[model samples]
Target: MPLFGRKKSEDPSALRWSREPLPPTPEPGPDGLRSMEDHRDYLLSCLTELPPFSQHLLDALDLSICEDVYSAIDMPRFDNSAMDGYAVRAVDVAAASAEHPVSLPVVGEVAAGQDALDRLSPGTAIKIMTGAPLPPAADAIVPYENTDRGASDVRVFAPSVVSQHVRYVGEDIRAGSQLFAAGAQLGPRDVGLLAAIGRDTVLVRPRPRVAVVSTGSELVEPGQELGHAHQIYDSNSTMLAAAAKAAGAQVYRVGLVSDDPESVLQVISDQLVRADLILSTGGVSQGDYDVVKAVLPQLGETDFTAVAMQPGKPQGFGLIGDDRVPMIMLPGNPVSAFVSFEAFVRPAIRKLMGVTPYTRPVVRCRATHDFGSAPGKRQLARGIVSLDADGGRLVELAGGHGSHLLGDLARANAIIVLGEDVTQVATGDDVDVWLLDEVS
Candidate 1:
């Protein structure tokens, strides 16, 4: 059975299905609801089709390589001195000691980038600065402290070995060697490496451009006077924008819209020209004023489904516009929207940017407090995961499990996941933990 375009019922109390009989308690199962992994795979299947270009030199610092970066020249292209010392023939100072000192005439002085035309022979030395090219016929270096520290003539009291204090050519990196592989995230050091290799810019995957929208008639911008008694602050757009930015995507935040389908559709249409992904929070539930549901399906192949998950069960996803940009619809509640982003949208953005292993780090830990979950529905409850004195991993609920509880979500470092069959979890029971703080 295809679960791709399953339409959810407008009323949960009187559930009805178009193709088959409704199950008890509106519990979506493996056959009815799309699994998290299946949905993620479907979203990632078309990401490779994103166009790549190397013509534009990346002006910003945060970028990732799309292919392996190879070196054009050998590192340390020439043999240079590693210390400020006298470049001399090792044989001249091989037998010199404190009691029987050897003297050598300093023929010339050389600093970094200076020509080393003077040749060093037996009983002669060149006063070489650090990073200076080695003079001809010089085999080793004698430090200034071991000699008289003189510029014209130097006396050596200690024996020196061949190739001492010398930096050989191609010692750090050889020409034609690969510096970094594909999918490697580039930082300042990586950029510097590319510069050292004589490349003005590198081929990198373009950052996924994300457009965030929040919908509701009973919402107003923060710091403004709330004239209506029912109006609350619109925070989902800003929060989702920040989250997308933190995941390495370029974010464009759309202004808040009312519960009108036409207005929401127009805003999404306007953003399709610039965005690679569109994320909207609010108005996708079983309510009459569900703006996202009413607008998204009219534009493209959007599917409004009831997933087997709590707080964010009413979800929607599809491709839209001529470019077929991916769009994710999250529930209206702030906590629910944030949780859905962490679980799905963030990873999708990373995947669009060619990042591998995009999912959050997961760990299994024993629950320190008792918690209850709805029957036959997966639950992702906020929790603070920590290690005890004995190195035992313990997980405790951050606060109440309500979808509107932002205080608990702020304090949570992890999302404790309970299975569909698990109705009640007692203390000491192990649960899978999705490490939210690791990525956010």
Candidate 2:
């Protein structure tokens, strides 16, 4: 019989001995707080190398090539005119000037896109348009203003220099050379360059697929009425999707899940099959209804929990399901979720997406207020950045530092990072800040 069914006399210590001691709680490292550096280092360690996949050339990819040199073939590809005037040999207008003008026969006209059949004779000129390839015999182009044109002849009042206003072959790009190098993100100019080189496709890194899930029964989708109590609008999914897209990932908004272990497990199980990375918000904390923390162990092992950061302290990371897709669990608070994503999730996504290291540009600036924090934890404060009197950058803290203050987050353009062991910082104190906006 089982110990619970057996009589106490049969096995007094059986019940007590059968019970297992609670697993020892993980001790927080260094002052009982995990610093930002610790969180970063831990995340970097968990990333596994992903297999390469073939993607279409036209796909919206963030290219990793930085330099590319393209060659030009028959640059201009033909002899054309360069000015909206006339093409002639320099010797033809050698002695022509305002005081002693020279007149010659303009036997034919050549516009850009049209070829000139009549070649220039020794003393003749041809009317040409801007961008028209220079004729083979022409060595200079005189502006229309410097010449007077008749029905079949033209008069020149200003002498032109050799090769003046003429676009030479292979001047812009030679026939053969290295086009774009590795690590360059193709943009409009790159597209034009590729087109110029007669290339319709290019090799690029495939975008990483990211699945976003927002957890919480209290979260109500927009356009739906929220119950009178304990209900909040679902913003994490949209926000995370947009952020992931901006970070060059193909975002699959997986919608919201209730705070139920079964539902959370189902969502992760479904997403793990398709996503390279799974990002979920809420349920990682040790709350009574925190289903994620419970389900994570059942589905996969937790990588780490409870990063030592304010507003985003309840965070977790782990693999999901048998597919082993990396998953990040962020807190339910809107600001907390956003901050956690930026601090931990974004870097991993960037790394997998082929973004260069040190992509987030940091700047040293002065704090405009006396911001204070606990000595043991790292704090990321939202602030507005501006240039100081001496042209140095300064960050001003936004009001309302609470984790749930979405309005403050909306107004913030920078994040002031206070490292561990630092308690208080007075105004004008030098600080390290990540600029959220372009500083002119």
Candidate 3:
């Protein structure tokens, strides 16, 4: 099956998404310590791709089409001139060249989009502009560079062949022909082509609405002055909101909520009207102040699982409110939250939007330094990946592997993955890298 479109029942692993989601993935081991793939797949299985809608061309950027499209009219519409010169019978210019130029009276003029003038007689010519309808009985054109351009009369300096510089009807696209198959994603060029084929709107999956919230009594807005040394500004909501936006989601960044269970539950409940997906940062760990993990149980069927991954092991997933809007609870620490988003949330958002291959591109590269990993957990280390002198990819760890190091996460352009059971890796060893940003 093609790896990338529709009818919600289809599988994205083989192709693209639809309005409904794929089947439930297998559960984790008896201990409930989920692997990265199991956690991600479970979240994906809980979602339904946003339903299709008839959206105008200007508003449908980056959306996948829900159905095939057929053109109603021919692309050229008629035989037209492809050059600004003269249109005449090919036989008329066959013997004409620079040395023996043929002079003919210019009976009329036709600019682009204008109706053709009277039919051409045996040896006469019709001056025409690029895209102008070819005159009746005229089968060829001589470019302005190949002739002495004239208004009343024209001189052909070179021979012209039949159909030269002429755009025939339906040459580019035929009427009633298939223009796009079901599940084609729209880019700028695709939009232009749809417009050229006379489409005002197309049925496609809508961008998912995602709500991002951060919870903690110690967390304050970025601009606020801190009252105590222990207090810290919340950055997870901002980062995750921006990330969701970049992934083509409609984001509602509910910046900060107190750690109280009632407040957390109320805020999350209010978001269900607009959110298709929800992301809450902090309060999933075993700490006494972890209210999100505590309050979410009252909202819907919520699960707090220890995912076997470094920096982001504590994870929570829930179907909140009566609508069952899916929610993911991330680690409060900056790096862990970001890494969890890359592994789980980004694909979920893309799947909801029905986009293909809803995951970051992974490439194999050599590590520039040595690193160690937990014996039974996956590690996503921040790193800077670059091309070597010979164009081979090489990566060096950006900052020490600390979950709280936000500065290093900002500097890195890729995630260096260390799988479970990989106790240590030596310098120059091959590693799989997930590209996070464009490499120049």
Candidate 4:
């Protein structure tokens, strides 16, 4: 019952998804065609607020904080030595020099995680290891290199500066101060900080649950024998599922569905309870066997449209079911699905989890090859962006501009965004490229 309500159409012709005379494409928006940014905004508008955070351990990476987190105690917690050295009084080592060395009795030895209960007597020193607590009454640290590096007794050959190599309490962060602001997505460094402050768990936004399904009768699973003529392997669902996971969403791959309209409806109905977002590939296109197009409209509120982008033009999105989960329909081509996920779905996933700066970092680089673009359509062409010998950033095309070019998608590390007004990019032209992966 949670997946059944939808405003029924009075006319029977409005429900058809047959290839006979495919539904008329919506008129292009005023800016020539629906710009990539416009389509993204529309998708975001339909997606409602995600649930708040639950307590998550520090080891859970890529989770965003739901509220500000303040430390209960100061960072470092106590004064400690920054290096292996001799803790001594500043005055005792003041006149010591390499030519005329001063010797002091080693009163104690302090190692990390051990308390230093012994106070330094005048003219004596304590041998300290790195991260060891400084002895009481010791105001300076003389490095081993400046001394004889002895355990019984140490020699001071240089004047030690006051508080040298000493990490004071509250130096990094003060007690009760805000450690991380609300909406902060924890990284490795952040995890270290939280662990250093003795936090076992912190409140974090729940990762969005995504259900991915591929719809096409011509699809076959990889590793299986493809005896049927022209049967393509089901790569779209796998690619989208991985992309969703990489974007910090929990993914449930529903596998490949045939062109049976009734079965497509059933699969979507079953997945409604588990999915915050539903993603389907193949069946939204203008084809006779596009079962998702035929079946989705009856299930809930949805839309099928053409976006003015190369490769991933045919787009579908809308809210559906009692929970109003957002569903995005993508093209079956491997390259198109990948590009659309990077440009659109990735940002949506990040936004839902309250991640700041959700979009991939963009940089302007000198084009090393000419790239042709479609007229009146924005193009996201795959490219290899890297730095040259002279430290200048350069970008070159990765593969041919075809939606089915899976090899190109695999080799691409960046996307060269070409605007509708631009037709071609010549060598040495500055083009904006969105980084696809981490680059040194």
Best prediction by lDDT = 3
Off by over 4 Å in 3: 1-32
Each candidate structure's TM-score, on Cα atoms with residue i matched to residue i, is: 0.83, 0.85, 0.90, 0.90
lDDT of 1 by residue, 1-440 (tens): 12123333233223222332112223345558755555555556644424445633444245567778789899888888998989999999999899988899888889999987567878899999999999988989898889888767888989889999988889999999999997787777877778887887777767788889999998898888897688898888998999999888888998698887777777777676677888999898889898789767655666677777776777878676544567888998998898888778877887777776778877898999888988666788998988878887889999998999988888998988888788888999999999766422
Ranking by TM-score: 3, 4, 2, 1
Residue 256 C-alpha lDDT in model 4? 87
* Rank list by lDDT: 3, 4, 1, 2
| Residue-wise C-alpha lDDT for candidate 4, range 348-425, written one tens digit per residue | 888777786868877999999777788788899999888889888899999899999998889999998888889988
> For residue 236, what is the lDDT in candidate 1?
89
**Clashes per candidate (backbone, < 3 Å):** 0, 23, 4, 0
Give candidate 1 regions above 4 Å deviation. 1-31, 46-49, 55-62, 94-104, 143-148, 155-160, 365-375, 387-394, 422-430, 438-440
Position 58, candidate 2: lDDT: 51
lDDT of 3 by residue, 206-298 (tens): 888889999999998988899899999888999999999988888999989999877887788777667889899999999999999987776
Mind giving the per-residue lDDT tens digits that candidate 2 earns over 26-123? 45686565666666667656665343334334562464443354665746566555668888899989999889899988877778877665567889
After TM-score superposition, the amount by which residue 281's alpha carbon in candidate 3 deviates from its true location, in angstroms, is: 0.6
User: Candidate 4 local accuracy as lDDT?
Assistant: 0.81
